[model samples]
Target: MAASSWPVKIYNSSSITTDSLKVPLHAFIRAYDAPTPSIVVRADTQVFLDSLAFQDDGKVLGFDLDHDGYDRLRNTEVRYLIDVYMPTRSLASLRAMGSGDVVVTPSALQNTSVVLTTAGSGTVFVSAPSIELANLNISVSGSGGFQWDVPATKVTSGVDLSVSGSGTLALSTTTLDAGSLKMAVAGSGKAYVGASSLVNVSSSVATSVAGSGQVNLYAAGTCRDHKVSISGSGDAFVSAMNCRDTSAVIAGSGSAYIQSTTTLATSVAGSGRIYVAGTVPGGLPGSYTPMASPPVTTYNAVPVPAYEPHKTKFGSHVSTGTSWTRDNATLIGVLVAVLIVLLVAFGVYRCRKSGRACFRSKTERPVGYARKTSTENQAPSMA
Candidate 1:
């Protein structure tokens, strides 16, 4: 489908080279090659423009978010889109802080180490298949979703994923070939990992509410070691069929599932249980539905709604507003001419009846009437 085109406001035009960029507003960032780095922001109101900031240096570019300033534009029809142009190298990291959905383009990353952080009530879509990072770190700490679907991503060192608050970090279908993988979840958050072969995998979940913090690990191949810790009502599901060794500790009513072929070292407290896969009473938790990755977005201009022109309290006038026109002046002149003709005709009629000349002169007069002297024309003395 063709992308819509909306009006754009270039907030930051001067290009600066930067490897790390931060977007703190509701904007879409697309990466393109250019001589220097630039940021293009499109917004309906000046509020977003007023709160925009850029770094003078060429290393790090930051956009500061003003809470009160952004809130004033919350209920209005304010849309934001940002275009980012970098050098030939890829953007190394990104930090987004907003409640506005932002979609990152795939060509935005070509680095060995990339770190992405998201906060606020917005969702960030990262679906770059060509991304190959040595170290990948993702952290989410708000009521939002961080959808990372880089299945072909290869991690040489480690991979870290964490979720707090009522957020989710979904990477279920993503395959990672890493040395070690670490996952953590707290509060009412959730985490999902793909079935990948790893040397070491560690996961921990702490939750106070029922069906809260949950972690699901799907390792189809060989795993050197797997470790898990659960507390409160949290649960962990590990599907490593050929794991060499496993260690797990559960407290409260939590549960852990390890399908290892070698040794198992576990500690349980209260009603916690350690079971194998498909051995549960009924089935896995009904609430453990996999989170699907959001569709990739094409950075096209969004359509803006049409609105009527502004009107004044005096009402709208199609003609030349409150000023008079040449047509009005011509009409007024015609009326004055007709009025003068009528007054002259009336004076002639009155003169015939009174038997006097309407225009007074010193010598000229009517044929039957005598000429009026200066004394007669003037009024008598007041005395």
Candidate 2:
């Protein structure tokens, strides 16, 4: 059969599926969103190739080459470049399985799900300047790269992005207002969620970096929770503006740096380092001990207050009371006393619960003794 004789197939359906495609060298394929679902295959010149075939079974349309003759053209030279076009509707699910570079542009896809996978070294680019979709999934196993540039307004549900076998994945967006956003890297691959990639999420985000892979996430907005695990020699860097809860587990020599509005629940089993910052309202775990540091204040240079003169009703000049200074000495004293009492109580509670002394130095006075002496002194004053 001649390659030029390959028929163009069109379907009046809501979805499209294609078998595994193995495009010969110098051939290109492009798929985009359209008003209807259609497929077109065009070649520069006629060439005899009995492996090509196209089928449309009412609901699903597929195009592929026969395995027997496809293998025979593995080393054959191609003088013509064949172009394949598969345009689908926004309500359709376009599932493409191949090892070729796929480019998806803005407003080109509003499908329920857009799945693209490649087992070879073929890059994938999905850019949505405007348009929202339910799901977007892309995976690459070879040394190829995947880049997704979309805004939060363009993704209504979630995104699952993954790269393996030394492939790289990059997701860049202004905000991601989805239920969840997941990115994973394995087998020496690298994944990056840029500074403003996910500014806001409704549910949670989970990331995994294993097998010498590296994952970097920065400037994430408010979310319900976040979980990240790093194994092997992989490293993960996460920084968020705000979140309800966060956790990280490092089991290998990898390191993780996380900064969020709340403290993180972390576990470090190997030589890895976990750096966490922000208010820890929930406090650290029982097995975790934090080093205390004194608070530092910064003073700015400013002029002292000056009061302007004002005339009273009696025709006498008087200075206007424009500013007043508050006396917070008593408030400070009370706050300090309360803080000390709370600390002593917490120490005693821990000692009693664990059945062990919670003091670090033997020369220091016990919390109970200090509380007793303070109580006795205050009791005398009260009397």
* Candidate 1 residue pairs that clash: 195-218
Tell me the TM-score of model 1.
Answer: 0.62
Q: Which segments of model 1 are wrong by more than 4 Å?
A: 1-7, 11-17, 55-57, 64-68, 71-75, 195-211, 219-221, 278-383
Model 2 vs. true fold: TM: 0.60
Residue-pair clashes per candidate: 1, 1
Clash pairs, model 2 backbone: 199-221
Compose the digit string of candidate 2's lDDT tens values, residues 237-276: 5544356777887655565555445556887554555655
lDDT of 1: 0.52
Q: Put down candidate 1 lDDT per residue, 1-383, tens digits, no spaces.
A: 11125444454435455677766544455676665566765554566557555654566666553444445545454445566555555677777664545567757764677787776555667766546567788877666667766656666767788776666666633455665677777655666665444323332222121234666555453456667776555666554433666566654556565644455566654445555532322333321112112111111112221211111121122121122443344335434543543454455557646877544322322222221111111111110
Over 4 Å off, model 2: 1-36, 48-50, 55-60, 79-99, 105-108, 151-153, 195-198, 277-383
